[model samples]
Target: MAEDDDIAERRLAFGRAFIGALPHARALGMTLVDLTEGRAVMEMPYDARLIGDPETGVIHGGAVSALMDTCGGAAVMAHAQTPAGTATLDLRIDYMRSATPGRAIRAEAVCYHMTRSVAFVRATATDGEEGRPVASATGAFTVERGR
Candidate 1:
């Protein structure tokens, strides 16, 4: 239906704007690959400037963390119950392994639960590899609605 398509477009635009508005996300070249209610996927391309170690050529952990965090916030913002704004309250990330050199990293986040004032999100980052994730994260975010 036209209404459904309109809503989807609006949400996608919101997700793009949200990522574009963040300086860190811009600097890291994160792309909004997909977005829907309660879910978002983002990608960060591999760049030598973002390498953590010259010897390993692995992407920095901080860049991965930022990608996950931004993806989580986008998921929360896209949730049906979330209206105006969201902010990261807490995020815990576990690095499973270094990202494969020269490979772009993709992160997907789901807003699994939401309360009146908070949202819970889980996310995973992979470096173009199937089954093996570079990192996984869980986060809580403040939610503001009806604004």
Candidate 2:
């Protein structure tokens, strides 16, 4: 294989490794869908215990934001082609509709840009119904320098 191809293979491997390193993420009940050069996909299944309002069975907005933030960070790390800590500079999320309990919510995140010190990303979460997004987010991230 060519040198670039070799590096690409290695980066993908590193993405998986970095993901596995976050055990708390596992306890959060999120599943890794995929990671690419400037993107990451994930899924979170609805659980009543994690729901903000048990009566409504709707997942909390804060929980949705956390998922998006994580996705943005993962996207930055994958696209930077380096292992790094990403801090949320700004995050905006819009809740179009409420999430239903027991449904799996899928998130798709893309890093549109990553400069030397920052990364820009957007992600959306949905439970497959078409009219409205369960949640959507856009954020800027600061990539830490050095260890």
Candidate 3:
């Protein structure tokens, strides 16, 4: 039991450090909300500076893309057999609607599959609502071995 607890603590610490080390994540105020094997959730508070259109105050699509990409990377790291590090190989995001001006956005990612060299992830960004996503994404990441 002690060993399990220690492992969990270490994993949480590592996840925190990983998110903290990214400049863009830090700039966007991204927080790791939850993490487990093969899954991760992250949140970014609404900020006026992130609004793409000053008139409408809609959060930029780029911000959503960045959130999903970071969340996907975190999901890959949460996978039980993840490699030393990972890099995005490809990412595609489809925006369904604009994020509400005053609402924080959250992204959830699942690493559904992994190979020796690649990991596949699906992710969604939403304004804390069910079924109404601001955007959805699918991504491939390169799994670096033997760091």
Q: Which predicted model would earn the best TM-score?
A: 1
Candidate order by TM-score, highest to lowest? 1, 3, 2
Task: Give lDDT tens digits, candidate 3, residues 47-83.
Answer: 9999999999999999999999999999999898968
Prediction 2 TM-score vs. true: 0.83
Off-target runs (Cα >4 Å) in candidate 3 are 1-6
Candidate 1: tens digits of C-alpha lDDT, residues 77-119: 8888864888899999999999999999999999999999989
- Alpha carbon deviation, residue 127, candidate 3 (Å): 0.4
Instruction: List model 2 lDDT by residue over 11-44, tens digit each.
Output: 6677667766777566677766787788888777
- Identify the superior model by TM-score, candidate 1 or candidate 3: 1
Which residue pairs clash within candidate 3? Answer: none
Against the reference, the lDDT scores of all candidates come to: 0.93, 0.79, 0.93
Q: What is the C-alpha RMSD of each candidate to the true structure, in Å?
A: 1.3, 2.7, 1.4
Q: How close is candidate 1 to the true structure, as a TM-score?
A: 0.94
